[model samples]
Target: MNTETNILNILGEQIKLGERKEVNFDVANLHTASAINVPIIIERSKKPGPTVLFTAGIHGDEVNGVEIVRQLIAKGINKPKSGTVICMPIINIFGFINLKREFPDGRDLNRVFPGSKNGSLASRVAHKLITEIVPHADYIIDFHTGSSGRFNAPQLRIVKHNQQLRGLAKVFGAPFVLYSKNLNKSFRTVCNKLGKPLLLFEGGKSFHIDNIVTNTGVNGAKRILFYLGMLSSKFKVSTPKKDCVFIEESKWIRAKLSGMFKASVKINAKVEKGDLLGNITDPYGKMNYFVKADYSGYIINVNESPVVYQGDALFHITKKLIR
Candidate 1:
């Protein structure tokens, strides 16, 4: 489908482009059952500007944002003198070849949103990837980490009322910046109901690779492509605080009485309103069960699978929620 109009979001939905490198390279239901093809890539830049998309492993064990988009595609993009840069490293190849993190139909591709095209098959592949790659993107960044057993650090989670998307999440520095404030149903609420502007790089976990959340998400996506001029020089990015201590509200503290667990607070600690965040021993510790912190923010995430079950999930509190 190269109608002489540049080639980047390069997907052939109705089917066309051949020498494929995989981007919307269909296969949803063409004969059998073992299928998975959702790829996209673009790099345009003969001037023009603004169009920076960069997603990754939509929860297929959050592969460090597919290594932070191949470290910004090896820092090239050939001609971005002004704009354009799209990528989708790995949307979920059967939950990344059974590495497992949801999406082999167990569903959870970012809670399957903005989808439909006759739904189901992960809602028609998340509605043909939000109608063929995020409405032509002009700012979307979804790369995560912190799932498998659980671990996060290089932060930068926006949705806290999008103050310029939390000033592009502190120029992607990553030392802890988790504002977050979406009422669930994500993909950052389907790119905030179409206005686009999105960002959610939680940082390192699941199968591991935490070079400070991949160097603060590859230099915060090239300091947001040089703060959106597409690049003509721009690289300081990292003041990291737009008052970002919101956490308007949050919840999830399971394992009410299981077996192992120890946590005495670590992953970004800062508790108080009850503080104790650790306990649930048995196998030989002769029974214990502390784990308290009913209120007072900043534990961001917990649970490293030291074996537990009475309810599973251990900590995810954010209090004062943000948004």
Candidate 2:
């Protein structure tokens, strides 16, 4: 072990690998009638060690994760170090351009896992990703943010069944952790089945940059690199609150009345059963309707936009029914 460490140190000191300017993993024709291929490459290290894959913009509008990946790539490139970083800063170029959640053909890239060779554009992207990259990753970090009309506190999303995922979640150093059992057909789901654990970090509601939440995410990924022995200590990391709620079941509370919304509760606020969450008021300022929680829990995500109609998802509350 000592000899290996010394060798790593020597190799690290002597390391010199230039970052690739372009790597074509798959071919695509641009809108200008020119043939182009999507680029994906690993910035390799001189020292042989673990390789981590950082991906973002699976849903183009979710910008924080992309920023996190881009920032890390820049850091790795500017300072050569141990291990390797394989990055794909923009995964969904179509959605990125359109600023939509789904692909150009309206396919959710997250749902099309281990995708087909001869399928839609989303499927082809997924297929190329899984085939060319994931198999080589020792650890994975995929970034995500809340979608349209929803706001989420910076948190880690992990499946309840996997302890490896849980361990990785702690490395993130976030205040909350959401147990999303609905990983079916998702990128993390397929990877878990293949024995490659991934941490799906979520924060900063869609289309908006929540500075506090984003910084938490940006710092969390950098902290993980240190914890994984991939980088030397360069900054002081805060002691993350381990007092996270283990929510096994998270459900959306629907608005019963059709009217403009008045959100009375904020994200991360705890509420008891039957507690008044907020209310809906008609445009005329009369005919007010009260919305209440069916179970006691904390508010992780809430509808930010005020104008809402009947059956609009108002709150995403998570109950600690199971540990």
Best by TM-score: 2
Model 1 clashes, total count: 11
Q: Write the per-residue lDDT of candidate 2 for residues 128-202, one digit (tens) a residue.
A: 788767776778888888887788877888888778777777777776888877566789888887777788888
Candidate 2 accuracy as lDDT: 0.74
Q: Estimate each model's TM-score.
A: 0.38, 0.86
lDDT of 1 by residue, 1-323 (tens): 11223444346522112212335546364235756555565656555556677888877777878988877776653125655667787877667777778865698877778768886666676776787778777788888788758776566666555677767765544555566566465678877888888877787588877776687677777767776666545344455443445454667778878798888898767787787888988898688989888888777778778888898888877766544
Candidate 1 to truth, TM: 0.38
- In candidate 1, residue 27 scores what lDDT? 36
Worst 10 residues of 2 by lDDT: 3-12
lDDT of 1 at 253: 79
